[model samples]
Target: MAPTESQHFGVNMSSLEFARSVFGEEEDIGRSLTRGSIPGDMESVTLDSSTPWRLKDLELPPEPIMPLLIEAYFSRFHWYILLFHEPSFWNKTYKVYCQPTWRRRDLSDVVTVLIVAALGLQSVLQDSTWHGHNTFRIHHINHRQLLLDLVSEVRFHLIDLLANPRIEAVQVCTLLSCFYMFHSSPGLAWSTSGMAVRAAYALALHTKAPASQDRIAAQIRYRCWNHITVGDSFVTMIYGRPASVDAAFADLHELEHTDDLTIPPVLLDLTGFSECGDITSKVTFHQMKFRLYYIIRQALNRFRLLRPSQPNTNDDLVAISQEIKDVEASLAQWCQELPSLYNFEDWSLADRWAQLEYSLQNRPADIQEHAEVILLQAAMIQLLYDGAVILTHRPLLKYQVKPMRFSGSVIDSMQKSLDAVIGAALRISSFPVHKFEKHFVVSIVFHYLFMAGVILCIIPTSQPLTNTAQEAKAGVVRIIHASRAMAQHNRISRQTDKLLTELLKIAVQRETLAALDNTSVTGYHGDEAEPPLLDSEMSTTKDVPLEGPKELLQANTTTIYQPDLHREFSMDLPELLQSYHHTLDTGAARNELSDQSLLPSALLPLDPHSVFVSEQLDDIFGSLQSFYS
Candidate 1:
């Protein structure tokens, strides 16, 4: 569709001229027109339709093409152009003239041309659908070339124009930032990003700019989105491949106000770019995440390293501590800040941002399963901190250095702090929390902390020498008990009350004689010195032949057997002992039965016959000793 004549005219007029027409001639149109240049007599230039349109020609004052061409022949040129030779003249002249004014007219013409060119390039990248065969590589190369030309043409002039109108600077910077970030060649994009920052700051510092500080702050925020875009680009590039997560991070940090913690959410919309499924873009997304993580990690590492040393150095330790506390506090506050819930599963740019409230505000929580990942990360960090605290407290141990000891109070405080965190994890794992299904990880963390606590409790950091046997034995006993307690607590369950079920089992077994009743029994010869017995009488009778070498079973066919074969009888031990001693001797069968009870129930049951009839007569002696000895 062709633009109407009036639309063309609107595009040609500068913002000052448009403003003049809107307010009528009585307004200060002359002053506005003077600041923005007018083409010198508008006659020396010609519209070069055969070649790519020079951006400067498009930014010229509104005038008839024929008359402007005629007047150009007589105009006196500037000394700067006179000094340059023919080749340089054309290049430098075209360059200087392209950067003219901040008015709408100056931008519209060039912007319109650039937009059309961009659309053409986009068509080529999208041309694969039309062609049925992929022509993306060819088109992609062409597209990059076109973008490079466009950026080169606009870089200088755009910066000059944006120096006073921050909003305009922000808009231009944002567009340029995207171009730079998404370009196949990001090096070119970075150059423009640098220019954009210089322009934004220049505009921001202008005392005469009409907006109040608060209003300008909003504008600055609006502009920051561009820098954020640049940051995203750097990250994506570095992460999708191991290009340089740190370098990409450096790029993000280079932008002014990148850490303001109060920029507009749109600026921080790291996920808003085109789908990065392609090879080129795939690394881009990863790099973006890597960059953000890198930034946060670097900050954290720096704070950690600096924090401890602050106390020993001339630096203000309290201030450094307060800074860290501030960041932590801000993080907690941001989490509670009502998130933008307008979009169901898709969060809006606005929803994604809450002011840094503290220093660690540039983090994102957008990937699938991020909650579990972040939870583990938080726990890992907590663990490292706990270990460090422990290391600093240990005294004269192999792992401990004499100069590395922390104060006793410091160790005590850190232990308390860790205990609280562990307690929170235990509570989280035990009860269901909304939007927190990854409680299993929390359970693991809790278990780790609990075991660590037990170890810490049992191992003395320092102790006085004492009685060798008694002290050593007491320490061993203490560790054994503590280990048992830790093991009992470490059992986690996927099912509700699974822990309680096992606890109930233990309670029941403790109170009932069911376990004792299953013990192996001993054999006795009526008031005679008994010979050994055979286990064939104690094993499952179902697996044993009923008449099984009757001598091998037990001497007496009169002996009675119960469903539980552990309890058995024998009238003749000597004959039974001779035949079965090779298979099931009973020298200490009662003791063996007692030991077998400790084997899990899932294994074989202890035989009562071995304990009752053998030397284990002690088991039954308590109840019927009068009949035995």
Candidate 2:
């Protein structure tokens, strides 16, 4: 050829693409052609030819509402999970729905548009102002009914995609996975997410970004794979399933900026944080989450080696102590290196959460609106860090719960685990019920809440209830209250509410039983005994459902202590993470690592050259001093 298109552009190109790289093409086109050819599997064939999930038959929302929905999706959810190319998404969605009766379309593209609009509609409805908007009634379309229909149709096509997957299939699968986790079918969410991960592998997305000629396609591939692996990683963190793409994360570039995530002017005015994009770019949020997941995965790896269910011996437990220190050291450095805006170690977590709640209650004249995205991102990242701390230290707690005596190091590790996990829970439950969207709870936020909630409920039964412990119990109640409010939005949250309430009742009853004769749900049996508080239903703890674990709630296990020791739960988060403990007769005492941090002083190895030069300088200085003398 006189001059190939690849030669002209100085990048490889498919013949049909001509001068149009992924940048020039629409999002839908770019998605299908990421592999540089029209993939046959990308074709959306009929799962049932008789009644396909056809766009014409579905009751799409009024055209005016589409833009509003898309904007809501971007402002509220996009930054949390970087799933789309913002500019390209707008181009593709507008091309499909903006026209009257839409002449041409891809079913996959149409499904994407529909799902985004559905989630957007859900977000908009959260305000309670949109429930009876005239547009929906005037069109004779019920908003709730319309939402159900969109979901049903997606399920129809998802069945086909399950057998014959494509790039867009990965997108839908990821979104649907999230939807199920908190929304409708939480039981299936994990399995659906697993499907999304394998689908990404089918496309070889883990290997590398697919587009060499266009930056947009590269960004999309990176983002697409990020959601898949991160979603998988989160599931692994919570569920302890093996990570499917744990190794692939090492090669990933930080999530690229996308126009789709830009907060709309309406939301900017509403949230009162106009400078959010600049303060903590959405790109930074994703990268922060990505790196956090890597460390969490590493912690899980070390925890697995101990096998809480079946440890070989005390020596086996001792073997991984150094490895635990290394992972925690990594987390400590991760926190230290974080941009100051996200770093929150200086203040007490309880005080910090109270300050956040105060801001929500009484904002300055300039910024009064609630649930700002940037602020919420900071809270979520903090929770992620706290959750990582728990994951790192929980194995020791598990062994300690069993009542076996071991070395001082094991006891130190156990106390660290106990305080970190419980402190994190108190911080989590302390998050004001008013903050964050009522209808939409981010999965990560709720997941950590659940983790912390469990720790708060069970840990205090074994230990005496301090004022801190009582407040923590109240915090768990608030969690129950928050879960109830969230339950109205999704089925699983309702179940979560029921589960947490039951767990709280059991924890209190166990505490009450252990306290005996004193007979107080919250009494610590120390100087000036604290009074019992919260629900009248909890005044009587016996005959409550034995839904919790037998080993935990039923038995007078060491975890359900006899109340001989009364270690007051009074310390900041940094204090709780301290390495040393004030030894107790029962082998469970917590002390602040005040002298030295839990982690080593340095994160990375000292450079040999720097060390040698410093030594050389010391020698020269010594010689000079001696000569002068």
The candidate that wins on lDDT is 2
lDDT score of residue 6 within candidate 2? 31
TM-score of 1: 0.27
Q: Write the per-residue lDDT of candidate 1 for residues 522-584, one digit (tens) a residue.
A: 222246664443454243122222122322233232222111122111112223224223223
lDDT tens digits by residue: candidate 2, 29-125 = 5454443333333343343233433463566666776677677777667757777887888887557555444322355677777777777766666
TM values, all candidates? 0.27, 0.67
Candidate 2 differs from the real structure by a C-alpha RMSD in angstroms, to one decimal, of 16.9
Instruction: Please state every model's RMSD to the true fold in angstroms.
Output: 27.9, 16.9
Cα deviation of 162 in candidate 2 (Å)? 5.7
lDDT of 1: 0.31
Q: On a 0 to 100 scale, what is the lDDT of residue 168 in model 1?
A: 40
